[model samples]
Target: MYLKIDERIFRELFHTYYDRLYTGFYKKTGSYEQAQDLTQQTFIKFWRYRDSYNPELSVEIQLFRKGKLVFIDWLRKESKERQMIDSLQQQEKIPVEELSADLKDSLNQAIDQLSPMRKEVFNLAYIEGYSHKEIAEKLNVSVRTVETHVYKSVQQLRKILALIFIMLHL
Candidate 1:
């Protein structure tokens, strides 16, 4: 069935439900700004899909469903962003020259054992402080390739350092 709702009815529906929707979103998100944004987006979706409104269902039910979907998408996006930030933070926490002299010597040895290309990539990124994009441009390779080289270099260094630690302990 074709559903064409009048602007007057739509405005009335929005006015009646706006507060409840905003309050629900605010309770769920715990941020006034995010609640306001999601609430506005919900109404925008309702306005855009007004023609699809099912007369059999209440407008409130349809709006709630759309709002729930918007909230879920926001949550997933937030989770991914949080994970990226945490990963970057962990990488930044790795100390360079602050290690003990022996550990530093071992680390230098570990780095020296990497393949030439991997060693260059690692030095450019960690010591020289070049970003992945900058390293890619400087080395004339894809950013993904630069990242792979750095990743492999780090893995090899970790294994070598682990062995050194074990031998020192023994």
Candidate 2:
């Protein structure tokens, strides 16, 4: 079985889909700008794939599914951008005297997995440039323990970040 889609039919189909796709994305994401962007992108996909339209597959269903994926991709990109921005803000608040960009990105990934006390001690010692004695006094622990936590935390954060770097390169 074969179907021929003319320019008039394509225009009509596009007209019917444009509003529905925008509404679907608006409901999913609650952002008019994002919805409008996805709506335009959906039509671009429509134009690019016009020759492959399959009447048996139900054009409306296909369009809806493609539009949904586009909206979801946008959502993922927006979420990642927010995370990167937050990490940058956190890094900025730490004084420049103690920061290394590679170390900060590593610490962000590893700090969450540290024990609460170790995280506190390690941040003071490395991020705030506090000595072991000062970190110990601040956290009310012995200097030896503060030194140990900083040593361990640095080792673990480096390993965690090495894996992240490898995965990114691959």
Candidate 3:
């Protein structure tokens, strides 16, 4: 059954349910910015997929379901990234003091070699302690893109650091 929903009805639905959706996301995420972002994305997805929605289900149900999926995907991605970082840290185990002045310079030089967007994303995520979502919003990019940049930056840094460590030992 194709249910045609007009713009007015869509706007009304958005206004009626947006607060509740935002609240639910806020409780789950514990971050206002992330909650807002999730809420916005939920609505965007709903609008995009409105044609396929089952008329039998309430709008609230559809929105909440999409929101849950978005939240779960976020958690899974974050978990994977966290594990990668943890593994890297354990493997490298480099103390800051152990890095000689030349090694420190080499690290900086390696960072400078990163592409501009990757460097900016890396700095925002690590140096500024911003979450991937936060960096995405600030940079007007997707969360997945931010994740990629961070992952690549870490890989590059690890490689450079490893080489420096080996050179220092020799």
Candidate closest to the true structure, highest TM-score = 3
Name the best candidate (by lDDT). 1
Q: Give the whole-model CA lDDT for all candidates, comma-separated.
A: 0.84, 0.72, 0.80
Write the residue-wise lDDT of candidate 3 on 1-170 in tens digits: 95567789889989999999999989988878889998998888878888877788887787789888888887897798878755643553355467778877877777798889988987787656677788899999877678768788988887877887788789
Worst 10 residues of 2 by lDDT: 84-93
lDDT of 1 at 158: 84
lDDT tens per residue, model 1, 117-165? 9999999988888888999999999775786687677778889999999
lDDT of 2 at 168: 63
Q: Which residues of candidate 1, in runs, are more than 4 Å off?
A: 93-170
Give the alpha carbon lDDT tens digit for every residue of 1-170 in model 2.
53456788779888887888888888876778778989988877766777776778887877777777777787797687556534533553456447678756655777887878778876786567776678888888766567557666666766877887787689
- In model 2, pairs of residues that clash are none
